[model samples]
Target: MQVRHERPMSELSYQVSAPLKLTLEAGQIVTIKHWSLDRIDYPEAVDILPKSGLLSIPFQGVDIQFFVEFETDTQDTYLKFKNLTGRQRETLAIFYRSILSGKMVSTGDMITSLDTPVDLVPMGETDDEKASDTARASPQFLRVIWNVAFYLILSVVVFGLIGQQIWTRISQVSLMHARVVAPLVEHRNTDAAYVDEILVAIGDEVQRGQTLIRLNLPEHDAKLTDIRGRISAAETRLQALENTRQVHLNTGDPTRRVLLQAYNQTVASLNDRNFFSGRDLDDVINAWHDLRDFDDLARLAKGPFYDILRGLDVEIQAQNDALGRLKRELGNHKDAMDAVDIVATTAGTILQIDVFEDQYIARGMLAITIEENRPRMVRAWLSEEMSQTVHIGMQSRIRFSEAGQTRSVMGTISDIQASIDPDISDDFGIIVSVAFNDMNVTQTRHTFRTNAPVTLSASKDWADFGSLIGLER
Candidate 1:
């Protein structure tokens, strides 16, 4: 809050010795070697770099000038020598000339000064070329030195401008990175049925786990018919024998009556409930029938004579189960011709269907896709350097290229590492999640279910810069 200004510092000597012609730019801090306040020959002044302010104070045995930049009403100045060991109040008073000049003198009369005095070599050199004219014409080596000095001065000015621009560019920084995806599900039981016929062509809408196609077994019907016929024949013969044998038994024929009656009763027992003597008669027909005769009649009689079947329904269930397993296995083949039943796995609008019903498909085929529900989650990783700067409950903005719309979202920094990549990785990035904020897409199209990539930007901490802006009261 205090105001002060720089006064030029010079290394005083009666002789003018501008050796080396080393140049230092404005605002750059450089060391003055071979010069100290302790030297009598060097006097009390320092060789200040151009544009720097210096204060002279009596030190040890000499008046020592230390470099500093003084502040005016509201501007900043980098005081070169932060701390000084000279007499404090005396040195402060001597450098207070500019402050007094501004307060006491009129603007037109006051001397314009800050860095100009440093160009004067205290060893008897001045900026006025006219005053030094007599000195300039004296010697051949002196003329040469003068010309060299002028070239050296021009060179310093040229390089300084270039160096400043280079520094500014180097100070600029930006951030961007490649995205990492979180796979929705690791594995799936893709092997499934297709009962409802898939109506649309490829790229048709299909929900997750929705039934798509139905598989049919053309041979299932013929086998059903043959098993039924045998059951009916067995029952009819047993019935006729039962009526005749009972009458003979009454006429005193004991052996024939026993055999005939036993047969009729056994037939009755077999027709009880499609479970004939603990055996599946359908299976029996299947296993023992003639392949060429085509057992349609027997299979057709199944329901009517179901009561007389064998294997007690277990064998029948086994056959059905075996057929089911086969249908499931065929789904893996892209060239499957069998009918099937496919169902949707998740709740979503079907996006597309790649294949049609009655069409053969192969294993691991792309059937269709679904665009999932809302409140999409986007993830990003921050560098280890920013781990501390970023924290939970920070706000972020996102813009999707396809949608061409902006979205404002709040983020909760769930995790942060003490160091980058604690182990496996050489570079570490902390994971963060950005939750959507009241942002809705009227347009229905989206790239993927919940995971959509978009450009992102983060708000940085600007408290220090804010001080310069007068935001902090």
Candidate 2:
């Protein structure tokens, strides 16, 4: 073998002194400069060479064969042997070994022509004897190993799941007949009335004092009308009394009349300025009385006109008081009419709205129901035997549905009470209530309103392995 001036690829690969002629099954002839047991290097245009085909190297009295594949590298183009038969591989190894041992070799001569006898090392044996000596197992043995590995992994998984179910049966208590609940509020019609308007719909969020429905009470209409009529009559009577008093004053003595006119002017001036103080009016009245008395004393006389003026004053005062009372009664009637607007007493979402416009509802009739906007809870009934496993402040998981999806929220047993009704106690069980955790309460407050069904599972602190083994714990 000739030492190549280029980089050495492997110890077995040799640079040939002369180019070796090779032919492809596709009828293309080529020359190779370097060859090894596994591959060959040749200078050829990659485009002209077949990608893969049978390759033949002419030797003395025989043709050495290989299946070659064309490949390109960054530095050069070459062909690698593909699907080499055992005999072809061994023949190539002998040729390479013979040349390495200082024997003259030529591709044109038979391999036996060499003076040295070359022993063919088995294909794929390495220099390390320990590794080469290891015998490869048959396909049947490999299949058995893979089957054993698969069964071992499957057995572990199956046993692990069975153990988990067994543990849960011992340590957990599941309550299935549970429901989500919150504080509820009811809206009842307080008086006999026809529903005039419904201001809210079911599922509407409302605030305290928000008007929910408007009722028009037919009974209030007659009372309001009567009060209004009385007020109108009282106002008319008051105006008529003022006319009669003016006429009565006109018939009084001129002196008294002049004094009355002057007093009236002063009162009008005070009232026009919104200065209705009693002290100002009293001062004017006192001055007038003093002037009238002085005048009467100076004249040394008293007249029927004074008596008439006093009587008119008394009558007008009585009329004014009556008018004032009538006006107050009118206001009270109006307030009763306004009370027909039913308002929310607590903030919440409206749940049931049974009344519609123009529908007559009686006094104390059920009209609407509201679910208060408070933290939701889950309620369940536990039997006496199962109740022993549950306690207040115990952790639980509450499962419910929202928008067609199942959800789980963590909660704690907040209350446990004996069934109040003897029928319920004998028929069902004890009452247990669960309060949701803060994180879940805020998110699902509206999602689970009153009476929404749920499933509650409370896990105990201790595991009862004896129970799983059919022994009492």
Candidate 3:
């Protein structure tokens, strides 16, 4: 078999002296700078080229008809003939060789026209000039910028929400079981007595210095009565001594009256002494001896008047001293009587009454339990996992139900401990004590119970957010 060789078509072009006007479909006019039998060349007018079109060229007073399509190469923009018959190709060849070659195309020369309407399908928007036009029509950069910004903001919001949830979970330590507690003020009786009257019942609100119970203190009462009796007796004895002295004054003997007056003055002076020690008593005895000497000197004339008066003066002084002592004792017994009434030392509500009317109570026995009228506190148990996170003086939030409504208050971690409470039977975890803030105290003063349930929460340090998410070492 013999291999037949075929010839490839030649690529040739020619420049026109004057640009010829070529009109395409859609009235698109382009200036042809170069011409050939197979194609025509023009400056790039649009980014996308028309795929195919029917073209007509006027040559030798007859029109040569063919189909042409746009194409491109490295050097120039041009169109190539397509869908041409052999006869149409030969006609164009003849026309190019004889008349169109080296021709200086002018406005009066051969005119090219497209017959069928060219569909302007978009190819691209990359041409610099056409792209500028498209940009002016609608800004693509701004759209891209806005889209990028929207996605950025959306990402930030999503991360922020996730971070908030994680932070809320880790920043707080919960107490599984907690209660609203207040300090218990125990009212104990220091002296043994019988409860004469129960003035206040359990849960009754009492003010400071208000009597809660009256006791029948038999020993104290007996001692008080005895002191009163002694005081009365002393008063009687003192009045009797005064009467005896008045009797001596009424004797009407001028010398006897004068001597009795002197004796009374001396006794009054001695009675003025607050405390008489052995030496002071000895001095009084010496004064008495001196009075005896005066009496001895007047014995022959006055006949024992001075002696009788001196003895009466001494008796009056003894009654006066006894009255002073009994009165002082009475005053002490009166003070002890005040203690028989068990008055409240502080304002509070009575929690427990251990004794009833006529019940005998011993010294140092708890008579009543009073809950002080003060701010409420929360006692909670923290888990071991949160032991390190919770500490004293940390800020906290406490919540508890009151009158079927939930209420929250700001508080502080006043105390945290691992010790056990002897009063509590169950082993609650680490102890946590929370004190309400001053503003909340006023609102919750009367609302708190000794063992009401409560919940506690605390704020977190934001710098530890990364660590909670495992994003930091």
Candidate 4:
């Protein structure tokens, strides 16, 4: 993107020729075309295209409308917002009106038409000629500027009085503290969640039994299934073995009639040889009994297979026990969540909401705040010497940042802090009270549940303004 800019002091004006062709005078705005506003600070959606081939004029200063036009291409430029403050508002209004009304000549690098009567005077022309050749509306435009200034000055006075009346009822000793803060949480924990968040947010109101985190659970779920499956298999196998044994005892042949003949042969062989007496032949008798039972046949066919099965059963039982213990301890591991009850701990507007949906947040993070709605207070710490002029219940005026718009509560000083701590960064603290005339707007402004430092100014009378102009007090 090529940046084309017209300097403020450039002799060329921002007005154009032809339909709007114009010449410029001192202090006249010149249009800047093809300048990239991509980097310019503006809000999300204010597009002001620098028109091509026309005298350029700065039309917007208030509302922070910006442009980043690309060189020759209409598609490349992005816009930004730069909202003007109240004072800048009036100035830009007059300037923009003059440019749009064709009262000023447009001058810039992208000049499209120079048809305005350019007497073509050389630089060496006499001062009189230069003055006479000036743009026709310069004097009239100057008058418009003066009018804009007049209105602005009047607005300041009105705001001053309003600020004074509002401050008179504010407390002089309200605390203005600053502290580092953490973000709010919105989810639960899981088994994979190894890192535990330790701190909670300052302003978040917490509810009981809220699950704060979620760890990895898929692995745990798989383990549980495996354990239960093994237990069931072991129990079924044990039952099958017991039923087979009972059948063997109920039937002498025991589904092994074919093997009974072998038992008979062994018995006959032992008897014919007279290998031992009845007591000594017990081993031979036991061998014949096994030949008559199917279980005995199965054992002979498979060595230690039953022993292996028994070992597997024991292992399964142990796993089942371990799994049960874990389930009890973790409380199903299904409902863990972190939530907070945002009951109005106090009445006030929600100062801020920290985290947005779907964004991960730390546990116990500040989510929102409720500004205090009470005796209007202007709490400012004063130097030990300055304290001499201040007294309790003395009417005090306050000034808030233009952003603060709390109105409703207003009144008198009813309390004051007796002591001051010099070691503080400000080295002072004071409290002033205003009446409760207004409370509705406190919920909208001047309220904070968590601590965020803000600026406050207080004086005994509405006129006693302080020199410290910076907002963060």
On TM-score, the leading prediction is 2
Question: Which is the better candidate, 2 or 3, if ranked by lDDT?
Answer: 2
TM-score of each: 0.30, 0.52, 0.49, 0.26
Model 4, global lDDT: 0.42
In angstroms, give how far residue 366 of model 4 lies from its true place: 5.8
Off by over 4 Å in 4: 1-320, 332-349, 357-376, 386-425, 429-473
Give each model's whole-structure lDDT: 0.42, 0.72, 0.70, 0.42
Candidate 3 regions off by >4 Å?
A: 1-169, 199-210, 254-303, 383-386, 402-409, 423-429, 437-442, 445-447, 464-473
| Superposition error at 126 for model 4 (Å) | 29
What ranking emerges by lDDT with the best candidate at the front? 2, 3, 1, 4
Q: List the residue pairs that clash in candidate 3.
A: none
- Residue 435's lDDT within candidate 1 is 51
Tens-digit lDDT string for candidate 1 (251-340)? 542433454555455545555566545564654343333331333544553333333343334444554555455444444332343323
Candidate with top lDDT is: 2
Q: Which ten residues in a row have the lowest lDDT in candidate 4?
A: 35-44
Decoy 1 TM-score against native: 0.30
